[model samples]
Target: MTDWDQTDDVGLMLKKVRGIASDRQLMFFACGCCRLVESKLPAVRYLADRFEKDAERPMSRDEKWSILSAIGSALLGDIHPILRQFLMGQDNDSWTMAAQVASIGRMFEFNGAPESLEAAGPSIPRNSASQAQVLREVVRNPDRNIEFDPRWRTDAVRGIAAAIVESRAWDRLPILADALQDAGCEDDELLQHCRLADHLHRPGCWALEYVRETPERSSPNPGDPV
Candidate 1:
């Protein structure tokens, strides 16, 4: 259903994004996805402006490229720009998926980059506080397995994405893979989304040589300007 319903959610919104044929509609749905996931991180400000402009007009090839680049960069906490090499190998579907996952990851990092936890290693650092936050967002008499806030799901998803990229060295993509293999995950699309996150997180090993290790700035605290 269209976002006009207000009942439209992240899953519904993403599917709508993939099917949209008009540039205006695509921009609208894409921005709606970002809004739904709370992608208010400062890194996406340029992007928010870009889409805001597009919401009123059509995008040029360069503008679309900039949008995708921003999404990829934001996923890495605005650290790494999207390298030409990564985009060179992708088709439309592949890159679109990358953009969507990056959007979610950005929201997850809204509080900050979680730099200390990342430095500890490839774990998600999803503390009890994160889980508790999800529980609180839950509604009464919900379906058997209702989704938590999209922002809340990011803890595990972000770690899984990082692990997917880190796992390339071992000739395996565990975390999400093992979950899917053991029938622990119900959504087939989630694995691919995490893989896209992994790709955006690091792109390739050569990226490690450069691309500043930490984001230039942490997310703004409450009351700080966007």
Candidate 2:
């Protein structure tokens, strides 16, 4: 078994994470240790373990926030109930929650798992309509700061595109197309749209066309106005 205390860097810590006991306390401790290490790999691995263990052992609000704090701005795909739990808590840290929400929203986009969103909130029915509403709120919320992490912008765009297409918001298709062309989205993100478009049976989709026509832009220009 891997030794948690001896694990110094992320690579070694990840190996230790698998060896941590399955109980909530151990999981929480591992998560805390992972955060102390301050490495993205450990944080991600810790989150993955917590998410899986959460299935059998429900985490308290404090534990949830602890995990969220460690996950800070990391790309945790899909709408996890843990995120909703964090949001509903009394932390009053809106920025952190927004970042978490944005990450979860991106996950939903990549996986197209509306069920996960439904799982987050029992009140919100698990269906395409409800999922669409949540996605719209996150994407359109001016206060949410969806673009806080530039590395995640492509994920956010892909999520928005998925929601638009999945919701059959045909009226928004042109708008999404325009955004894709102007936003200078990454190739992987554009490819996600192409796959989604094909699955939706919408041939020659605007997103795919945009991907085909536009060359990848170089690193974002700081001087360029948004």
Candidate 3:
């Protein structure tokens, strides 16, 4: 029932995948949503940093609670009200909290004005669409399993994937694709995703997940510099 392309509600899309996506994956989605507004809100950049790090090395529930509480105290006063609402509702289900973060992206754009949503109307839909794209690229599909050859994770593939994950250097994705090819990877979808120019590949990317051999529920460090 949820149209991935047309719907402007990123949260709805995330909701559809709540049962399927891992917590780290949801955090990655939240970080992607936060990055959409990070330039306008520097405080949000810190939030995104923490989320990305958490996505790679997921905290225990108590650790996440403590860290989010600290982050909330430090950031709640500085962000837009919508973002503040999201931070306040961290106890909600992962999809709900992540959807709240996406809502912040949909509603605000900093332009040295208090009430800028009206002026930011055009980008509201654009941000929502972009957030939806992030969700799609990260989750891919609910039932489809990407079969990657274990042999494809040669040293070169591991090195490239590690570097990209550490630096957030997505521009090197194509190079990673080349490494996979050299290692005899035949999965077109997996290889092409690394080569795709327009996609916003992030920390929990399925291709990188494959390289790290992370199960849907496992939270591995993946060499992310926290």
Candidate 4:
């Protein structure tokens, strides 16, 4: 039986976690605990090295939850965002970096800043609409990439549209509708734009007209109004 309470023996257990080939459950538990420990350690250089090494391994469900919980806990206080970024990683594999960005969006929502809400809007992927709503406070930050990359721009646009529709922010509907009309908008993003226009009772001018007039067909969402 692995002793989860043995904080002092974490170094030994981390070695076991690295060596074990078959015991996935134990490996996951050990990795999760190690992540917790890594979050607390002050040595940024060492922690960065460890994060690079461990991030290559697939995180088990338990391990992912553990890390997420740790992030949530850290966000409750005055912990610096830069510190959290260091603990998480500077790359795509760092879920914590995404979480911190999302958390900042939540802060914007609570503070009632619409500009902040718009600024943080594109950080979420299209498949994660529900989560995006929680982080709807987008502000215009000149330093970050608010515009979507062509590769994933469609997904980002659709995701933001879904979040706006869900939030019933009627005032923001025109801005979102305009984004939908961009020549660069993807099919999925166009569909989401149609939905947003329909939801806001402004279907004819921007999205609905475009969908109807354009030869390109969109995937139908059952019972969705035009």
Candidate 5:
């Protein structure tokens, strides 16, 4: 981190971040680098522009969410417009974009996004239950060195739970919830367990109605309309 902070320019920073041994670590540090280099207003905009202008840019699922997750905490005012542009494409992957929006929407504490998976459906259909099981394994242990130590795995559930939630597959959430319960996740963590109906401002979500609404103590950060 100290080394990254001292080094200058996006080019140098990208080289450094891309060189990180772990993809997850690369994502974590890349986001941090963006923020440290002046809160990523330009960087995020650049990414959005590239994503918009270049229709053929081949980005992996991991790369897409890494960008989203890294910027999850960013103020919506700074990124919403470009985000809107990205998510608005009819030919684009709604599932991926929906998951990205869900990540930020949850962190920002709202769901006034421009679109919903319930309306447009998923770009890719997946087995939510099995995916949830895969996620549970990873959350228990994210290490690669433990072959017999019970943490041995080659995949990252990454944020597939968030994607499933954003997809609004209401019926499939219980499968994830069951997995979460089996994995011993409880309380707030459990609340965030792919059941974003509670967090979403969008209606037609069971999670929203299932959990009782309470009085508001404060508003989220301004400039975050989404």
Candidate 6:
């Protein structure tokens, strides 16, 4: 009974989605959260891209751990405590980690102050609002099966989706939607999601995943392509 469209509290959304969302969904959400401050911290885009690529390629547990460890190490020194908490608190579930990253982005968005969580309390609502929208885009209607016609995955559709995913050029989503239409796609939900100018479309985006034929797995493996 969560009012997804109305609720802007990402913490609430994360609680609802924790057990149900796949690793791919959570990773996508995490990247989307980090993307909130990519302009201010250009390194965020690089990290997000690295994460997305790592998620898609198949890897052993050790490999996955190593990659995350390297990333965590790279983030050390002169970083915000929230981000430090995110990387060091490995025991946290993906939902909590993503929320922490969002908090870091909120900090960068304002003053890049290394404010403690308690000190950053005043902006929690605004931070949640931004992240909740990302969670919505990645998890839109878990109960509803948005059927996509396999025939719609034509060369143009796949190419557009791949380019969008690789470049993070979400502005081209409408053009992809147009290509889908040319391929006779009539799914309103899918079409509208593509054409949503205000929506943040990251790699592993639900619509792009559909077009790229990388559906969310019940038990996703990092070695498995996203």
Each model's Cα RMSD: 20.4, 18.9, 6.7, 20.4, 18.6, 5.0
In candidate 3, how many Å is residue 205 off? 2.6
Q: Tell me the lDDT of candidate 4.
A: 0.34
Give the lowest summed-lDDT range of ten residues in model 3: 217-226
Q: Model 2, 76-170: lDDT tens per residue? A: 32234454455555453323343334334333433433355445443322223322222221112222222222433355455665565456454
Off by over 4 Å in 5: 1-21, 36-41, 48-178, 183-226
Q: With candidate 3 superimposed using the best TM-score fit, by how many Å does residue 211's alpha carbon deviate from the native? A: 1.1
Instruction: Give the lDDT of residue 109 in candidate 5.
Output: 29
Q: Name the weakest run of 10 consecutive residues (lDDT summed) in model 1.
A: 206-215
All models: lDDT? Answer: 0.36, 0.37, 0.65, 0.34, 0.33, 0.68
Give the residue spans of candidate 4 off by over 4 A. Answer: 1-53, 79-226
Q: Judged by lDDT against the true structure, how good is candidate 5?
A: 0.33
Q: Please give each candidate's TM-score.
A: 0.34, 0.21, 0.72, 0.20, 0.22, 0.71
Number of the predicted model whose TM-score against the real structure is largest = 3
lDDT of 3 by residue, 1-226 (tens): 3365456566567656766676566667767766766666677678767766766664675565454444443334464564455467546545455555565555544233234434434544433567777787777655456776789999999999999988888889999999999999988778878887734687778778778776565242333222
Pairs in clash, predicted candidate 3: none
Off by over 4 Å in 1: 1-9, 32-40, 77-89, 93-226
> For model 4, how does the per-residue alpha-carbon lDDT over 1-226 read when each residue is reduced to its tens digit?
1242222332232233222212222222323322333334323224333433443356554564444445433442234454344434443222333344333423332432223334434532222232221111111111222243344335444555555444545456555545654535455544443444333332112232232221212223233233
Model 1: clashing residue pairs?
none
lDDT of 6 by residue, 1-226 (tens): 4476678766767666666676567667767766776766666677777877877776554554444443333333245656566567676444445556565555666656556756666754453577777887888666566777889999999999888877779999999999999999998888988988734666667888778876465454333334
Number of clashing residue pairs, candidate 3: 0
Q: How many clashes does the backbone of model 6 have?
A: 2
